[model samples]
Target: MSKRDYYEVLGVAKGASERDIKKAYKKLAMKYHPDRAQGDKSLEEKFREVQEAYEILSDERKRAAYDQYGHAGVDPNRGGGAGAADFGDIFGDVFGDIFGGGRGRQSRARQGSDLRYNLEMSLEEAVRGKEVEIRVPTLVECDTCHGSGAKKGSSPTTCPTCKGNGQVQMRQGFFAVQQTCPTCSGKGKIISDPCNPCRGQGRVEKTKTLSVKVPPGVDTGDRIRLSGEGEAGEQGAPAGDLYVQVHVRDHHIFTRDGNNLYCEVPLGFTTAALGGEIEVPTLDGKVKLKITPETQTGKMFRLRGKGVKSVRSGAVGDLMCKVEIETPVNLSSKQKELLEEFEATCTGQGAKHRPKEKGFFDGVKQFFDDLKS
Candidate 1:
């Protein structure tokens, strides 16, 4: 049968994004997987088709060729029949569960695992980025062996068992099952005399001190990735990355929401009644904010561009200051006398200024009147 168009096989448009193409292939691969379909040969053929579609579409160079020249561009061995596609690595990444190999077959030189470090920062430090030193424990390549498990004078030799394929096949009934070579441990090589420093692992456990540069406006749960700062890989594999997770400490003055900073500013009763300017604290410095006359509690005043700028984008946010009117405590004799005189004047106003208190008393009077009726 003639080969189907790569886009048609994956059921994706020619202009599909990389993410869209991968998503489409994942769906088809899961549906037509041989393990999912038991011993069905038709499903196996469909699975191979989906795999071939993904193999061509996922690669940028291959995708370009396939888009321009169709199958003839990618197939070097054209008209020689469809050889088993390089499904070993691809299947391991996608359907490792069905193959009983989690991350596909592990290479002899595998990249180190990625590491995460939680970094605690003060609100000031988070607002303005700071350089911090942290200690992380990870595997480092042995200096003595130079990443090779062999002794100083000797080198590793190829395994006698399974030759150098790293896998050994076993026949059960009529099906052939492939498993990692027991003797070689899938390395396909054996070290006769191990290095004295790292034993046979070729790496050592050590703690390293690293300096991390935190950008301005980074909030909690934000991550900064440092390349090649993680654990050292075995043999000659590339090192993984280190992720620094930010955890901003709670501040006594301000609470942050995204880029906006919110703060509760306490005001004297006199300031609330007769408007006055008060000094309000901000990340930059203290600024004077004017309170309007007869201002009630919970009134908010916004200071534009006074808050933090976002880390992803440089957009500045506003700082919201909420007024909390504070009542006076510990009155002197003269002050008490003046307050009492002021209370007498307030009583004459008939609760017009205190509408909430007037409403409560009006409700109490109606309840008594209802009882009498």
Candidate 2:
């Protein structure tokens, strides 16, 4: 098929100036835009023709060639056509002001990324709080190049492809895409003579030993931030922060809830039956807990201000101790005889000594009587 003339395709005269050509192209592009056309094959074909015609006429070199020699001068088969018009570029350049976001935004030296380190501590250490030392592998700025990424006494040069904008426009027929400059990797600069220690990245890996002071009562899922302790930035940019994620280990004897601590204390059956004082373990020390007569299992006792302190409110919590009456595991013959005799004394006592047991059977008896009725 015969190709249309570039001037005729854009509805412009042969003597049209660059500004006039650009204005005509913008109007035609908006009208024939694939988004506006909604998959209309004829509009898409017209858009392609408009794109090809504007591509040839928009540049001085291609336009001059086409004006002198027609389609043969700007043919890709003949090693011509350096690509002047792009779909996204038309919107970016012509309709950018109407829709916002057409300006080129360049980046400077890129900052380092933030880092996280999981720190595990014992419950005692988390409750009482202690200073802990940790080793973290991270990137530090190179001393030889002073974070410039260039060799000593030399400096980085601006990227030639992106012109220090750290971005480049790529075109594929009607499609246009903006991407990071491959030459500088979005740093806007290139190091011709990279530092020997850190190569071209401007930072080197090293293990840093840091001391973290844990506040009193920092529980699991708590975080401690260390400012400027993360990886060093590229090309002398500012460093990011390091977060220490705390996980308190489970204790053998104690479980914590919010600002309180809960523990189960085993009480001797004799001590539960007769009132007595027993020493129980606490984070502070052994504390005496008084057991009242007829104390039952699952009975909870509170020790005021003996638990973990609140890191946020500065209030001390109470320690809740649940007593579980322990039955005798191994019994001597004499102990078994004595227990039998003691049971015989309470055999006809009804609810006097065992109120719960008597009440349970009374309810069971009433349930059977109702069934009979």
Candidate 3:
């Protein structure tokens, strides 16, 4: 009988991507595999047909020739299909993503894991920078074995199962698949005489004291990296990096945003009415701030170059001080009398002395009058 179309055999479109073709072939290959056939010749034929289609469709040159001139262009043979697609590669392509890339390859030793250390700092400390010492407990190379994981007199032996190749080939009827050596667990070396300090793992737990230099203007969420300061790798691999995460605490008098600093300063009632100079706190000590005459509450004043100096940009930011009028509390009898006399003088002069208060009441009266009308 004439052969079926290659695309039809794999149940994929002619415009299917290479990943899609491989996905479809893997699905069909598993479904009609000889192990699941149970002596069914039709299922075996379907499996062979799927292989042939994949063989021609998988390769760029062969797929192009077959697409242009059909199966006659490639003149593919039976069984393995064109003899270009290896059975090991077919099995690997089917399960490579799940089993870590490819098979028959040496299993690489994993490097040390990166570590994170949370470093808390006051706002003053973050803005000025400091060098602090920290103690970190992590895995370090064993001193007894010197990271070899073997006794001092003896050394590691090659894995007998994989013959030091770190992989083993297993034959299942006609197909052979290579996988990590089970005897050595893919390390290709067996630690027959294990080290006493760290057993056979090559590393031990120890606390390391390290000094970290925190730069100025480092805000919360900033991280400083310390190279080769993390956990030691297995069998003499390179150590990972240590990241010191900074967390800036909330300030009592100031709040920072980007390069600017903001603080709320209480203004005396007299100072709000008659303009005066008051001291405002900054990162670089207190500075005298001038308040304008008739300045209202919630008025903001900017002191240039009084904020933090940025670590990355080296730019000096400004300090924003918002003044809020303070109402006198626990007043003496004389003070209460004076305040009442002052209120009496300003009652009829609301428009001249307190324009905002006069405008707000005028708006309220108009709103109620309009509702009645």
- Write candidate 2's Cα lDDT for 1-373 as tens digits: 9998989999999889876776677567657766668979999999778766776787688898788777766766432442334224434644454444556647587667767776778989999899989999999999888888899988898889899988777666655556778998877888898889999778999999999999989975566889989889878988877878666766899988778899999999999988799998889999998888989999999999989999889999999999998898889999999999999999999799999999999999999999999
Query: How many steric clashes between backbone atoms does each model show?
Result: 0, 0, 0
Candidate 3 wrongly placed segments (more than 4 Å):
1-103, 169-179
TM-score for each of the candidates: 0.70, 0.71, 0.71
The candidate, 1 or 3, that scores higher on lDDT is 3
What's model 3's lDDT at 303?
Answer: 97
Q: After superposition, how far is residue 239 of candidate 2 from its true place, in Å?
A: 1.1
lDDT value, residue 370 of candidate 1: 100
* lDDT tens per residue, model 1, 1-373: 7999889998989999986886686567657766577999989999778767776787677787677667766763431112235434444444554455553244365567667787878999999999999999999888888878777888778878867666666666544466778988877788899889889677888999999999999976566889988877766466777888676777899988778999999999999999999999999889989899989999999999999998888999899999999999999999999999988888857577778778899999999999999
Two-way TM-score contest, 1 vs 3, winner = 3
- Global Cα lDDT for candidate 2: 0.81
lDDT of 3 by residue, 1-373 (tens): 8999999999999999986886687677768766679999999999778866876787787787677767656762321123245334556644664545644565555567767787888999999999999999999988888887998888888888887877777666655567668898878889999999899888999999999999999875566889989888878778877878666767899988767899999999899989999999998898999999988899999999988889889998999999999987999999999999988988779899888888999999999999999
Candidate 2: where are CA atoms >4 Å away? Answer: 1-101, 170-177, 368-373
Note the Cα lDDT for every prediction shown: 0.79, 0.81, 0.81
Task: Let me know the TM-score candidate 2 reaches against the reference structure.
Answer: 0.71
**What's model 1's TM-score?**
0.70
